[model samples]
Target: EAAVTQSPRNKVTVTGGNVTLSCRQTNSHNYMYWYRQDTGHGLRLIHYSYGAGNLQIGDVPDGYKATRTTQEDFFLLLELASPSQTSLYFCASSPPDGSNERLFFGHGTKLSVL
Candidate 1:
């Protein structure tokens, strides 16, 4: 089974503050992703990576950045956080490159910006 872990679980920040969400997947997969969930947006990908030193900007990459440090580690950065950026963040990993790639997601991190 694939396992993905995210740190802090929850976060609270003021407008213009900075936040960093951390994620680690331990399934030896080749794809990792960061996404944000909101009432209207649903689950929107912010950033993703396939392997170490491989980073891909996702659909909603305006206010986020990500880095993959190793096969099991990935980090998401929210440098200039804002109230509109508040949402539930998730980390997901998919199986190795193949036909039936399944994505498994972490619990989530609830971020509230005031």
Candidate 2:
């Protein structure tokens, strides 16, 4: 099994806020992703990376930024967080073989923008 961990299980901030969500994977996966889950949008990709020092914009990249510092560490940054961006955020990692079935996910970070 893949070991993925997230920090600050929950967070709260006012409008136009700033927040950073963190994730770490110990399985040495090459693909890391950040996603948000909302009532209507389901799961929307925010950002992703192929490996360390690489980044790729996702479906919802307007208000988000991400960085992959190392193969195990990936971070999501919300510079001007808005209420619309409040949602359950998840981090996941997959092997380099391109098999989506082996994706492993972190518990999640719940952010609330007031």
Candidate number of the best lDDT: 2
* Prediction 2 TM-score vs. true: 0.94
Q: All candidates' lDDT scores?
A: 0.91, 0.92
Candidate 1: tens digits of C-alpha lDDT, residues 23-69: 99888888999999999778999999989999998999998878899
Where does model 2 exceed 4 Å of error? 99-101
Candidate 2 — what's its lDDT? 0.92
Give each model a TM-score. Answer: 0.95, 0.94
Q: What is the clash tally of candidate 1?
A: 0
RMSD of model 1 against the true structure: 1.0
